[model samples]
Target: MAIGKLFIGRKVRELRLEHDATQSQFAERLGISLSYLNQIENNQRPVSAAVLLALADKYGLDIAELSTGETDRLMSALTEALGDPLFESYSPTLQELKLIAQNAPGFARALVSCHQAYRRNSEQLASLDDRLGRAAALEATPYDEVRDFFHYVDNYVQELDTTAEALALKLGLQGGDGQPILTDYLDSQFSVRVVHGPSAMNAVRRYDPAGRVLTLNPYAPAETRTFQMAVQVAQLYASEAVENIVRQAGFRSEEAGEVCRIGLHNYFAGALLMPYQGFLKTARDLRHDIELLAARFGTSLEQVCHRLSTLQRPGMKGIPIFFARIDRAGNITKRHSATKLQFARFGAACPLWNAHQAFETPGRFIRQLAETPDGARYLCLATHVSKGVGGFRTQRSSHALALGCEISYASAFVYADDLNVTDKSAFEPIGISCRICERSNCASRAVPPLRRSISVDHNVRETTPYQLS
Candidate 1:
C-alpha cells in the first residue's frame, strides 16, 4: 500500500509563532528559503525529511507532535456539520476538506462553531412556535458540551488516570480486595468515615464534606457500594487534580465544567478500582472477557466495559472498544468510543443494533458480527444489567451495556470464537443514525434520509414504502 504524505504546516506555523521567529529567520535555521518555508507553512508543500530532522535537532521538538490528531477530528466534525441541508449545494470533496483542516484549522473550527450556533438557533425558533411570545435562548446543552469535550480528547485523561493508579499502589490496593483498602485509605488520609445510610435516602452515594461523613445506600449491591465509595474518594482526595483538568478544558458554561468535574471523578474512581497496567494485562490474558475481568477485579460488568473504553494510554494502549449504556426506552445514557464508530449526538441509537435486542433477553449476552454503513465491521457484545434496593417492592433500574471493537480485533475477544469473522455474509449491517444512513431498502427505516431524495410509487411496493435516489 502506498503511504500518504505528512503535512505539518499548521504545527510548523504554531511553533514559529510560539518561538516568535519571522519567516526569514526560521527558514535560515531550517536551511530553507523563505518562499519554500512559506509554501510548507501554507501546506502547498509537504514537510521534507531534512526539515523534520532539523526541527528535532535544533529545537528539541518531538516529531510525533507534528502529527496533530485534531485535524482528523476537525475533518469529521466539519463533514457532519456540512451535511446539514444548508450546505447541500456546496458539498466539498474529502481531499478539499483535508486541506481545510490541515492549512486553515482555526477557520475550520470557527465554521463548526457557527454551525452549532445555527443549530441552537433553529431549535429555539422551533420551540418558539409551540409557545408564542416566549423568548427562548439559543445554547448548547451542558451534556452536549461535555460530550464534545471528551470526544475531541478521545475519552482519555492520562494525568488523572496516572494519579489514581499511583494512589492505588500507595494504598496497597493490589489484586485481592479494593473496597476495604479504599475504605481504610479514606479513614487514614482524610479522617472521613464511611457508613451505610437509609435506603429511603434514595441516593446512591452522598458525602457530607463539612461533617467528613460518607454515606451509601444500604440497598445497593456490593460492587455498586464499592464503586460509589471509590467515587467519593476520588471527589475528596483527587479534587485538586480534577479541578486542574476542568480549568484547562475551556468549557463554555459553568454547568459544563461542573458536569466534567463529576465525570473526571468517575474516571479517577475507575482507574483507582482497576489500575491501568494490571487491568490491561489481565484483559488481554482473559481475551477481553468482561465476566472474568469483573470477577478478578472485584468490579461490575458495566465498570469493566467502561474501563476497557478508556485504555487509550499512548504507548500502552489496549484494544479500541466502543462502550454504551442504553435504557429500555432506547436512550443512550452513557457512551464513549475509542474506535471509529461514533454514537448519535441527539435521540436514540439505531434500532438495528443488537444493543436493543439485549434488553429482550435480560442478563444474557448477545454476540453479533456487524458492519456499519461505512463498511467497517465489528464484533459486538451486549447484555442487560439491572440494579435495585435489596428488598421486594422496590423500584429497579435496568439498562443494557454494549461493548465492541473492530472486526480485525475479533480474535482477541472470546465472544467471537463461535462466529466466522471472515465470512462477509455473516455480518449484519448497522448504521450510526437514521437521518444520515444511506441504506434505502431498510424495512425498519423510520424516516427518509436527510441527504437522499425519496420517491413514493403507487405502482410497486418493496420492504420500504419509498425508494431512495
Candidate 2:
C-alpha cells in the first residue's frame, strides 16, 4: 500500500508548546521560515524533509509517530457528521474538514460531540415513552460516554494490554491451560480461593474483594466460568494498570469511571486469554476462523469475535476488522470499527445488512458482499451466538455478531472463500442509517431522510413514496 504524506501538525504544535517556543523561534530552530512553519503547523503543507531531519536531529523525535491515524479517523467521522442535514447550510468542503481535523482537532472533536448530542436528543424526541422518562438527561449517559471513549481510541488500551500479556506469560508457569490455569494462578499468587457451588446462584460470577474469594456459577459454561475467573484475576492482579488508565480517561461521572474500570478489567482478561503475538500468529495461520480460534484459545465464539476487533496493537495489527453485536430488536449493544465502515450512533443499522439475517438461521454463518452508499465494499460475516446456564427456567442471552474487513482484505478471511466479491450484482447495498442516507430509492427505508425536500405522490410510487429532490 502506498503511504500518504506525513502531517504531524498537531504533534509539532504539542512539541513547540512543551518547549514554550513561539512560532518564529520554533521555525528558526527547525531551519524554516515563520510562514513555512505556520503552514506546516496548520497542516496547510506536509512537513518537509528538511524539517523532518531538523526535528530528528534537534528534538530526537520519532518520525513514525507522524502518521495521520487519528486525524484520518477524525476526518472520516467529521465528514459523516457534516453530512447530516442539520449542517446542510454550513456544509464545508473536504479541504475545510481536513484543516479542521489537523489544525484544530479539539474543535473538530467538539463539533462531533455536539452533533452526537443533537442526534441523541432528536432520537429521544422521536420516542414519546423514552422522552418522558429520559428527558431530564439529554446529555450522553455513562455507557455512551465509555463507548465513544473506546471508539475514538481505536478500542485498544496499550498499557493494560501489555500488562495482561505479561500476566499471561507469567501464568503459563505450570504449562496448563483454560480456567484451571487461571484458578491455579489466583490460588497460588494471591492466596485466593476459587469456589463453585449451588449457593453461588443467579449471577454468573461474584467476587468478594475483602475476603479474597471468587465464586463462579456452577451452571455456567466452562468458557464463561473461565472468562469470569480471568476478569477477577485482572481486577486483582492488574489493579495499578487499570487505575492508571481510568484516571487518564477522566470521565464525567463516578458511574462512568466505574464502568470504564470494569471495561478495562474485561479488556485485560481478553488479552490475557489470548496474548497478542501468539494469537495474531494463529489467526493468520487459520485465516481467522472464529470457531477454530475460540477452541484453540479456550474461549467462546463471542469472546473470539470481540478479541479480533481489539487486535489494534500498533506495528502488529491484525486485519482491520469492524465488529458489532446487535440484539433481536436491532439495537447495537456493542460496536467498534478498525475499518472505514462506522455504525450509526443512535439507530439500528440498515435493513439490508446480513447480520440481521443471522437470527433466522441460528448456528450458521452468513457471508455477505455489501456495498455501502459511499461505495465502500466489505466482505461481511455474521453469526448468531447464544449463552445460557442450562435450565429451562434459567435466563439465556442471545445476540448476533458481525465481523468483517474491507473487500481488499477478504482473502485473509476463511468465510470469504466462496463469496463473489467482484460480482457487482452479488453485493447488496447498505447504509449507515436511513435518516442520513443519500440513497432515496432504497426499497427498505424505514423513514424519510431528515430535512430533505421530499414530495409524496399518492398516485405514483417508485420504491419509496417520498421522492428526494
Candidate 3:
C-alpha cells in the first residue's frame, strides 16, 4: 500500500502561532527558507519527512497531534451541514472540504454551529405551529444546551475525571469489591447508613440528607444498586467540585446548569467506579470485551460501554468509540462520541443501525461492519438491556445500547474477531438520519433527502417511493 503525502501545513502554522513566533523565525528554526515555509503554511506543498523531524526536534511536538482526528470530525460535520436544502445548489469536492477543514477549522466549526442553531429554531417553530402556542418562550432546551457543551468539549472533562480518580484513590477504591468500599466510605465519611428499601419506593436510589440515610431499591440489580450508591456518594462529597465545574460551563439557564451539575456528578460517579488506569488496562487485557469487563468490575454492560467512551485522558487514550442508547421507538435517549460519528440531535437514529435490531434479539449481541454515508467504517456492537421492577405489575424500561469504533481499531474488539474488516462487501451502509442521508437507492428511507430533489413517477415505482433527481 502506498502512503499518502501528509498536508498538515495548517497544523504547522497553528503550532508556530502557539509559540508566538513569526513565519520567518519559525522557518529559520525548522532550517527552511521563508518562501518554502509560506508554501507549506498555505498548503501548496506537502509536509515532508525532514520538516516533520525538524518539528519534533525543535518544538518537542508530538507529531501524532498533527493528524489528530479533529479534521475528520470537522469534515463530517461540514458535510452534514452542507447537506441542508439551503446548500443544495453548491456541492464542493472532498478535497475542497478537506482543505477548508484543515486550513480554516474555526470557520468550519462556526458553520456547523450556525447550522445546528438553525435546525433548533426550525424545529421549535414547527412544534409551536403544531401545539398552537404551548410554549411561552423560544429558548434552547436544557438537553440541547448540555449536549452542546459536551459536544464542544469532545465528550471529555479532564478536570472532573482527574478529581474523580483522586477521590477513588482516597477512598481505597482500587481493585476489589467496589460496592462494599463505597458503602463503607459513605458510612465512615458522612455518617450515612446504606440500606435496601422496598421495591414499592419506585426509585433506584433515594437519599435523605437530613436523616443521613441512603436507600436503594432491593429489586434493582446489584450493579444498579452499586452505581446508585456511587452517585449518592458523589452528591455528598463531590458536590462542591461538581458545582465548580458546572459554573465554568457558562450555561445560559439555571435549569441547564442544574442538569449539567447532575450530569457531572454522574460522570464523577462512573469515573470513580471505573478508575481510568485500571479500567484501560483491563479493557486492553480483555481485548475490549464488554461482558468480561462488566463481570470483572461488577458493573453493567451499558456502564462498561459508556466508560469505554470516556477513556480519552490526554496521552493515555483508549480507542475512540461512539456510544448510544435508544428506546424501542428508535429515540436516542443518550449519545456521546469520541469518534467522527455524531447522532441526530432532534430525531430518531437511522433504521439500518444494528442498535435498533438489538431490541428484537434480546440477550444476543449484534456485531456489524457498518459504514456511514461519509464512507467511514466501524465495527458496531449492540445489545438489548432491560431494567425491570421486581413485582409482576410493575413496568420495565428496555433500551438498546450501541457501541462502536472506527474500523482501524477493529483488531482491538472481540466482536470483530470472525470478520474480515478489509472486505468491502461485509460492511453494511448506515446513516445518521434519513433526512440528512445522501443515499439515493435506500429501500428503508422514510423521508426524502434535503439536498436532493425527489421524482415521483406514477408508472415506475422503485424500492423507495421517490427517485432522486
Off by over 4 Å in 2: 1-139, 173-176
- For each of the candidates, the C-alpha root-mean-square deviation to the true structure, in angstroms, is 22.8, 22.6, 24.0
Q: Model 1: runs farther than 4 Å from truth?
A: 1-139
Q: Work out the TM-score per prediction.
A: 0.70, 0.71, 0.70
lDDT by residue (tens digit), candidate 2, 110-155: 9999988788556545333231323233335787778767876788
Global fold similarity of model 3 (TM-score): 0.70
lDDT of each: 0.83, 0.83, 0.83
Measured on C-alpha atoms, candidate 3 has an lDDT of 0.83
Among residues 3 or more apart in sequence or in different chains, the pairs in candidate 1 whose N, CA or C atoms overlap within 3 Å are none
* Local accuracy of candidate 3 as per-residue lDDT tens digits, 1-469: 3225777887788899999999999999999999999989888888788888899999887865665478888999999999875686899899999889989989999999999878765654533432352323333678667866765566778977888888888877764458889889899999999999772278888788798999888888888888888898888878888788788878878989988987887888888888898889999999998999988888889889888988888899999999999999998888888787877666678989999889889999999999998899999999999987478887989999999999999999888889999999999999987867788878889877656788898999789877999
Position 312, candidate 3: lDDT = 85
Cα error, candidate 3, residue 177 (Å):
3.0
